[model samples]
Target: MSKKLRLSSLIVGDAQADRVVPPTGFTARLTLFAAGAMAFLTVFALALSLASGRLAARWGAELAQSSTLRISAPAEQVGAQTAAALAVLESTPGVASARALSAEEQRGLLAPWFGPDLPIDSLPIPQLVEIVETEEGYDVAGLRLRLQAEVPGAVLDDHTRWRRPLERAAARLRLLGLVSIGLIGAAIAAMITLAANAALAANSQVISVLRLIGAQDHYIASAFVRRFTLRALSGAFVGTAIGALAIFLMPSAQEDGGFLTGLGFEGAGWFSLLLIPIVAAVVAYFATGSAARRTLSELT
Candidate 1:
């Protein structure tokens, strides 16, 4: 009761008390290493989340706005079917434009498989017509029915077969990134709690002396909280800086134009990384406070 009154007085009287707990090197290093490691992993998780989001948006927008038409028929009927498919697409309400791909364009698409010197004219390859949709988009079922009725050889493909899988993959990647972040937070909390427990165990004499000298539980806990929180903040800062530098050094998106290689921050994403240290500090503060209070309460 006397200790509580003294603590209340310390708060209300705005008086500073002398530090009662001596710091241990082990807990300091442990907290620093744990916070730094977690923060480093968190940076990569954040990058994965942001990059997957961008990929999802790009795939949705690009794939949703366009479709393809493949016309397979006899040499004489290929041109007529292509024309008929174009007419059907043009008269459609939601379609923005439909143009048959030229021979050169078709040959270029097939070049990887058939080689550049392969004679495109000798082969009876299907004619491909690209279809662009308006902002409102087109009725895919209705367009397919119209194409079947007008041109039997014409097949309208909305690219749904390919787009759905890509979208699902991107969504799963984003979810994985989020799960990683949650796991990282849990790891940080657990590590900080262990470090706090170790510190409390090592300074049993110091805690007993403070209690014998009329120190409140909050006072003792606050000492541990402040020390661990500052350590976590400093460690997270260093880790975040190193992670950001590593991300910056990664290959640019323009270099290879690959999704996995372009894993890094963009625009406001860089600013979001600044919150990592603050979050680490808060986590440390709460984790250490809880552990310290529990340890102190268990003492005589």
Candidate 2:
């Protein structure tokens, strides 16, 4: 349409048209700094969103298919109860597999709090059993009833109480991250609009002369729009690069590091970062153009 043509012509601007806007000033600095700062924050917001999403999916997948069983009884009865519980689980319709944890494995779990040198054998620790579920999953109520009847010491923890809250928290964190990005974009647009207005006001004399020479309002507005848009694009590119570098330098994802270390781009996720600068430019284009047109109309 005519609007696109006007924008395109302004982008491939004439030297004379470009001269109307100052090459360097407060407005230029404001636009660049605003775009850069917002873009930098946006990168982190994007990372947080993606990381939380991955975390939620991982938690859902892992927890959905697995559970734990604890057997607490007198030292002499522990082994008997564990065997009874295993027998019950093995016959359960939806359970895929169940294994009692070795004393070494249980010791490893307690080591973080109890220390590596703690004498696990001397303590009356509860027996732990890991349970993996079939695709259809086990009937929790039925399994719990069976354990209660066959093995009084056995306790089934499907992780429902634990997993639901963690998954919900991760999902909300992802939502918050997305909301932060939207707010950042709005902040960028507001800053660019103010900068455009200031630049237009300062160049009122130049605008008058251009008008007197029969330059159309659209042509005059395009120059300002194009300048601000390019400034936003350039600044955003720099900020995004620095942000990505910072993320790249962070600790690599590891089991020990958990969620914090994994807050970064992985594989194809890196490619999405490239879109930030382009989005910033488009936002600046619309913001500056609207500001310029409104200011010019008022001047007339």
Error of 2 at 169 (Å): 3.3
Superposed Cα deviation of residue 22, candidate 2 (Å): 4.5
Which 10-residue window in model 2 sums to the lowest lDDT? 21-30
RMSD of 2: 4.0
Tens-place lDDT per residue, model 1, 1-300, is: 475674455334422332566757776887798898899999999999989988887889899899999999999999888888888889999899999999999999999998999898999999999999999999989888888899999888898888889989999999999999889988898999988898889889988998998988887787777778778989998899899999999978885387988799999999989999889988887898889988988998
| Candidate 2 lDDT for residue 147 | 92
lDDT of each prediction vs. the true structure? 0.86, 0.89
What TM-score does each of the candidates earn?
0.82, 0.76
- CA shift at 261, candidate 1, in angstroms? 2.6
What lDDT score is found at residue 191 in candidate 2? 87
